[model samples]
Target: MTTVTSADGTEIAYDSAGIGPALVLVDGAMCYRAAGPMRPLAALLTSAFTVLTYDRRGRGESGDTQPYAAEREVEDLQAVMRAAGGRAALYAMSSGGALALATAAADPGVTGLVLYEPPFLGGDKEYTARLGELLAAGRRGDAVELFMTTVGVPAPVIAGMRGGPGWSTLEAIAPTLAYDDTLLGDGRVPGELPVSVPMLVVSGTASPAAMQQAAQATAAAFPTAEHRSLAGQTHDVQPDALAPIMIDFLLG
Candidate 1:
């Protein structure tokens, strides 16, 4: 594991493997370097590029300070890019995709970007309203539940997931959910995040239409971006299914 201190003095932890251009993976809410869906993705990416996956501040082995802001998260990515020898390809999922897009707009060192299913609602209002209420009320579990429910997962599935591996992992890092919600802004307006680098916006066929539309919106916003659909895949698309698409996009 390697470490770099962000401008705010928070120590960020990252691991690097493989050889070639550096690729930094930014995980979504409740995910760290060791938890959530990125773990398997990291292993697969290591075979192609020098993969750098880090624990976001306040999660895993990373250090955190009081009074968090989205800017600090952007700086964390900048710190990792610096640790990667100044430039890197970035792959961000969910709200992490939003963060990476925001960072790329400001940081020239991000040479390329790949975003998968950033959870913004282009047409849904009620869903986001419920999520905002849960977040404002400090109902972390309910916030997650609302998100999952809005994404079209059946109520039974959502209930079952509460104690499952994914839910357990999320529960452990619940503090970041509020941060994710903040970035999403109640899923009403897509923030102006621009990218000059070659970019790909990927979405799953099984995901909600709003999510797919958000991915489309992101692709439209980028000067040089393309959209790809992973047929029959959901938000939980496994790393194995995703690795080849990412490799082709990044290496092509």
Candidate 2:
């Protein structure tokens, strides 16, 4: 495992693999470098581009400091880009997508970006209120459950899924739940991304309309971007399926 120090002196851990132009994969909630949805995608991406997968601060092998700001997470990406020789193609999912967009907007080192299903609500008041309650109560588990529910997962099925082994794994990293909420920011207009970098905004066919709308909004903000829907795919899309789309976008 290779490592780099962020501006705040946090040691960010990352694993580098494959051979080609650098491509960094940022995992969403409940994901670290080795675990979560990005792991399989990293393996597939390794066959094409040099892939850098890392744990966000406060998760996996990375270090965390007091007062977590979205900017710090952006700096983490910058650190990895520096380690990759100062530039990289980036792919981020869900809340991680929001971070990647924000980072690409701020850091020119991000040459390309691919975002999948960021859960940004346009003007959902009740949904935002419930998210606020979950965050305020410090109910990380409930927050995730609420997110899935709000996205239209049936209550019983969501409950059943949460009771499975996979749910435990997701729950283990639940601390980052608030970070997603922080990025969503009361379900208003997502912050202006307006990145000139080449980008691909992808969403699953089975994902919530709100999420699809968010992807469209994101694509619209970029001067150069395309929106694609993965037919018959869901929010938890297989990495193998996603890797190719990501590679195509980054390599385009």
Candidate 3:
């Protein structure tokens, strides 16, 4: 993986593949290049866009610093955009989608964005408090379970994951879960987007009702955004099912 320096002198590790216009992939909480959905999606889009996938700070091989702020992550993305030849389109899944959108709202260099099921439930402060408490007490596993449960994961499923292979990976990045919560700060829809840059909001046909609503509301919040739902796809959208549609929308 290659590296780029963020505004605060943190080294961000990223893998850039293919050749053409730049496209950056942002994974959700606890996911980075080695352990996330972006790998397949990146391989699928390689022919059309120079796909870039990176470990967000504190995950995978990326560097982390004390006193983390949500804006710092946004700056890390700007650095990635710069490394992508100074401008690029972004396709982000889950919380990464929210971070990408926030960055685009602040920086005009973003050409466009594609967001898949960004969790933007309002009243975020309420949960952040509890999440913070969990983290402060060193209950990392419980913190992970709490976040999973908060996001609608069934209790039985989380219980099943307790001894599963990837539970350690989830617990390893558990603290950053709070950072994800902070990204949507207050969670109310923004009054405006930066310069009305074209965006595409995507949802799966089988995604939870709240996710669908968030996607629609997000599209409506933007002056020039389009929403599309892939039939037979759920929150974990399949790469084969999603790539072609994304390529068409992006290249158009």
Candidate 4:
């Protein structure tokens, strides 16, 4: 484990492994180095590139400064890239892909990007307002529930998840769910981002049709983007199925 200081002076904790080009793994909502699929995916990619996995601010071992903004998260990623010899490619998951695009746009040091199913389908104004209302009222559990349901979790399944093993952790970082929401910003894919880095946008065939459409829309935003769909995968994509595709786009 290592640490980098963001422009806002927040301490970002990260781990680096394997060797070759610097490749940073960005997590989606409610995930960090310890509690996500990135670790296994990183383990596989390490054979081809140096992999950096980190706790986004307010999650895991990282600090969350007040008045969180998208730019702050961008600086956080830049800080990690600098720590990786001043340049890196990004492999971002879900909303993390939005942050990665923002970072790559700001810093030319980004060599490439591989984004898996960034949820840019559309926005629900009511959900956004309700999420803010829930969080501001300190209803963290409800906030998590709102997010889960908004993302298509079955109501009964979410009810079962409430007291499960990882439910508390999800609630603990529930505020960061708003942070992810801020990145998506009404969910319609932002077509104005000026990222020209080589890019690959992937979606799982078994995932919702909206997710696949979002992936395609996201790919269309970049001139150099390529869109691909993985068979037999869902939002919870298997690491082995993804790692090879990532390697091909990033190294090929």
Cα lDDT computed for each candidate against the true fold: 0.82, 0.80, 0.87, 0.94
lDDT of 2 by residue, 97-156 (tens): 778877888888889988888766654567567766876777767877977776577899
Q: After superposition, how far is residue 138 of candidate 4 from its true place, in Å?
A: 0.6
Candidate 2 wrongly placed segments (more than 4 Å): 123-144, 151-154, 157-172, 186-191
Clashing pairs in 4: none
Scanning candidate 4 in windows of ten residues, the lowest lDDT window is: 185-194
Alpha-carbon lDDT of model 1:
0.82
TM-score of each: 0.86, 0.85, 0.96, 0.98
Alpha carbon deviation, residue 193, candidate 1 (Å): 3.2
Cα lDDT for residue 147, candidate 3: 86
Candidate 3 residues 1-252, lDDT tens each?
899999999999999999889999999987899998999999999999999999999888899976899889999999998998888999999888779988888788888888898777675666789899999999999999888888789999999999899899888888888887777777765546463778888999899888888888888888888889989788899999888877887888
lDDT of 1 by residue, 119-235 (tens): 766445675567667766777778778766655679998898887877756655666766676666656434456567899999999987877888888788767899999999888
Top candidate, metric lDDT = 4
Candidate 4 segments whose C-alpha is farther than 4 A from its true place: none
The regions of model 3 sitting more than 4 angstroms off are none
Q: Write the per-residue lDDT of candidate 4 for residues 1-252, one digit (tens) a residue.
A: 899999999999999999999999999999999999999999999989999999999999999999999999999999999999989999999999989999988999999999999999788789889999999999999999999998889999999999799899999899999999999998888779889999999999999999999999999888999999999999999999999999998999
